[model samples]
Target: MDLPSDTPAASRTPRPARVAVVTGSDSGIGRATAVRLASQGMDIGITWHTDEEGAHRTAEEVRAHGRRAALARTDLSRLPDAAGVVEDLARELGRIDVLVNNAGTGTATPFVDMEYETVREVIDVDLIGPFLCGQVAARRMIRQGDGGCIVNVTSVHEHQPRVGAAPYCAAKGGLGLLTQVMALELAEHGIRVNAVAPGEIATPMTGQEDEDVRRTSRPGVPLGRPGDAREVAAVIAFLASEESSYVTGASWAVDGGMLRMGPQAGSHLESDAWRRP
Candidate 1:
């Protein structure tokens, strides 16, 4: 593949913002997605909560692709910042054509032991943040009187329950419904809403080494490997493009095959021998 710095520029007409806004884009799937979009000739509005350096690196990659990249320092845990964040990007970029709600957080904890603060933060970031951004983007698109696309990055847990991830699951589940609602509400205005539910991607959020995350994590996947950031990004790009004019309110899972098994442990049971009558 062409590294951002090595990418050849393709010419295109200038559109407002001419860009895509990717939250949590300083690293991981967000970073990869931002760079991939830039390579396709879109400018980028990148958001980061903590990784300024990583954000700059992504901006550099965007520049390497001969596209503009603007970085914003944002913490989605604060509910009030969501709309403001979208507004700020709009002001800086001139327009918001594509909005990718990729910023989120989760923890591995039992629901009973979960603290309210953690629950609040996770919900605010994973669900409310996207809601706010989507609301703002929809209004803007309506005002512009042109169609736009919204892609929310969710997870497999949005469909299936997971152990030790109550708030995360709740937030993503809420987001899943929100995507549908937005699609319905915005469809008449020429806006499309969709989501990408990534299974296991080797990113910083997973807190696993890239190589190890790719290896050990894939045994359950029919494809036999963890998803790369680029794989998920491709889905987002397609949703953002005119190519997906008929697609909306759909969550595309990027996880290998982890969700296909109802109970991972049960897959090992193999019956009969343990049931002594």
Candidate 2:
């Protein structure tokens, strides 16, 4: 068949693999997601806060899959400035196809005892950071005239409350709603937005990095064990790929049925047996 006389050169050529920017890819779910996306043939942009070495290791893993990898240091607490890292990665990688807002922080202090600065920092990193980063990535995708995907890594706390996690819950809850709004608005541009809420994942945050989740136990959870980072990454990979092209504005809970337990988790527990399943 003959081509149109005015067909653009770029569109006439074969398209390259997608490129993805994953924040806090130095470890845990972030690292797992980056590698998983790479295995699917997408180039990855990795961000680290304080763990440069870990980020480099993640980049190496991406390269091991024969995908390109770029590195950047992102301090979500730094505000609007830190969000620019998304643009930086897009420049280095040639284009932006996906953005995973996985960088986060939390507080374990009692609500009443928490200092103003502490609350501000948590909200800044967990909520505002993803918000701004999404904006940067979305604008670029719009300019390129291609749809994109943004996955915000919220937590089970986004829906449920933990006694000492006031700020964390508030930020995650806000991000959850933001995902829906972004989905509604960006759908016209072929973009999709969604949230991934995890519970008791075996990550460094939970002091269970590299721990075999099968050997561990969680009595309150329906699955009777903590989740592995790879499990959460698999879900993220789906959302970031064409596999979930029709899905958006939704929250997928990758918690071993912990959310289903509800009040029964507490009411049914008896004695020391409550510590293990």
Candidate 3:
């Protein structure tokens, strides 16, 4: 956490504008977050894996809010190289004030039957990817001498494990701890870090793209329905904004009370179907 020769120990000056880079922003939670942050007056940097069209759509939405939007193709599996998207976006946006580590992948295979390559890919994309990207964003924020924030998009599995998603659970669990460590180490540099864990959201990853969440029902959840991507985005927006300046090293669960229904879920299961993917 060494500061640049010209960088001050801390900066108290007000900024004229803010910029944010959200990875995996081509759709779902990432797209919603980019749009929400844009509406809050922050220029957005969006990244896509395989959906250039979706990334452009996100950019259009950001521009509609009167904020600038920059696009890049971010393949987390590419490792150290892919993390450079943050630096590229920061340069394009002039400066970065926020970074949402939203890009991730997961596996549904059971631990015993999983392939090493598949596990490696999942961990690389979900855990190490965010680690490197967070470093890139944080170093720039330090050099800029401005206090900033980073929001790591973990999952509900970060706190609890699923039977068939051994690798997914492991990566998310690792990310949850990584968020805390980053928060602790970066506080002196004025960079706050936190994690947001989402439950079953109406996202393409959940096979519910553009689906109305209100029409869905989850008997085990107190809210009784899947959450909308916008709902998760709202929490991420809070973490990225100054409104949550004092909050760090915490994990916010946007799970419709599903995490609290652990024991109930266990007791109410009618069959062993829950044991498989």
Using lDDT, give the best candidate's number. 2
How well is each residue in 101-164 modelled by candidate 1, as lDDT tens digits? 9998988776788899999999999999899888888888789886788999999989987777
How far off is residue 159 in model 1, in Å? Answer: 0.4
Candidate 2: clashing pairs of residues: none
Look at candidate 3 and tell me the lDDT of residue 165.
87
Q: Quick one: ranking by lDDT, best first?
A: 2, 3, 1
After superposition, candidate 2 runs with Cα above 4 Å error: 1-12, 269-277
Higher-TM-score candidate of 1 and 2: 2
lDDT of 3 by residue, 166-252 (tens): 888999999999999999999999899999999999998989999988898788889999999999999999998777878999999
CA lDDT of each candidate? 0.84, 0.95, 0.93
Q: lDDT of model 1 at residue 58? A: 92
Q: What are the C-alpha RMSDs, in order, of all predicted structures?
A: 6.7, 4.1, 4.4
Ranking by TM-score: 3, 2, 1
- Write down the TM-score for model 1: 0.88
By TM-score, the better pick of 2 and 3 is 3
